[model samples]
Target: MLNPVMNNTKWYELRLQMCALVPPPTWSTFSTAGYRSQPDREWFYHFREGGYEDILHVDIQVETPVEREIVRSALKAVHVPGEETPSGFRVFGYLHDGQGAGYI
Candidate 1:
């Protein structure tokens, strides 16, 4: 009987290929109603109250699993104490490499 072995090369290659296929992250923006700006430049609002505004822009980068996990944990630790408004939260990913460089 022959045993089937999982080829991690194909998996890794596919992951790399898929990652390559995706366009690099770019700037984006969103607007919210009933949003309050703090002196520290943090905006507070609810997730459902406002729609994403095209005017507020940010650069978004594709995140790796470790990065995503770290961000998720960080978000969990953050505390926002104040009135919440809809459509408040801008998530952006950071890429260490693959920026301004030509792909093969």
Candidate 2:
């Protein structure tokens, strides 16, 4: 069960944080802020073991080159490693670059 008030407040906070992090001209819009269920067997096992198990996906879409670069840079600043290729997007754990531990 989700608490309406708490969820709404948290959602707004997240939206603001994202807007600040990406700013204008970099993130045209931020959408799909919601909760997701945990994977099947893992969820069941966690429930049985009285442990916490769940995951949330924060999805955003970027449109322009400037926006894409801003997002990629921001992720890198936070040590969130991402790959840039002529193909498409990719996400992975943060990897440090030579610059005193920055994302790669």
Candidate 3:
């Protein structure tokens, strides 16, 4: 998706679409949380030069292969402008298929 960090409006809209297209686990939670402040490293969270508050961690859960494809398509369609993210946000997905299709 458009490096949601690039635009607030786009991010908001995309976030809504993602939630609608791919629902997360009911038991899980949504957050903009990340390790931008931590010394460790991770790809699930998009870390930028900005502060941690700028990050948005939208970890979603897809229930089916079709849903997974849609989510993946949506991610591939967006064109993120500039090398640096305006804010500090990223999208993630977890497929609960038997194969253990973890994070995306």
User: Higher-TM-score candidate among 2 and 3?
Assistant: 3
Write one digit per residue (lDDT tens) for candidate 2, span 51-81.
Answer: 1112122223455777667656654444432
Which residue runs does candidate 2 get wrong by more than 4 Å? 1-17, 22-53, 81-104
Task: Write model 3 residue lDDT over 17-92, tens digit each, in one string.
Answer: 4545424221122334433333222222332224223443443344556655675565445542212112222353
Point to the candidate with the largest lDDT: 3
Clashing pairs in 3: 32-57
TM-score of candidate 2 versus the correct structure, residues matched by position: 0.33
Clashing pairs in 1: 27-58, 28-57, 28-58, 29-56, 30-53, 31-53, 45-85, 46-85, 49-86, 50-86
Q: What ranking emerges by lDDT with the best candidate at the front?
A: 3, 2, 1
Question: Cα miss at 8, model 1 (Å)?
Answer: 46
Model 1, span 6-74: residue lDDT tens: 133422332233233333222133222223332221122221124333112222223465444433333
For lDDT, candidate 1 versus 3, the one ahead is 3
Which window of ten consecutive residues has the lowest lDDT sum in model 3? 80-89
- What TM-score, computed on C-alpha atoms, does each candidate reach? 0.24, 0.33, 0.37
lDDT of 2 at 59: 27
The residue pairs found clashing in candidate 2 are none
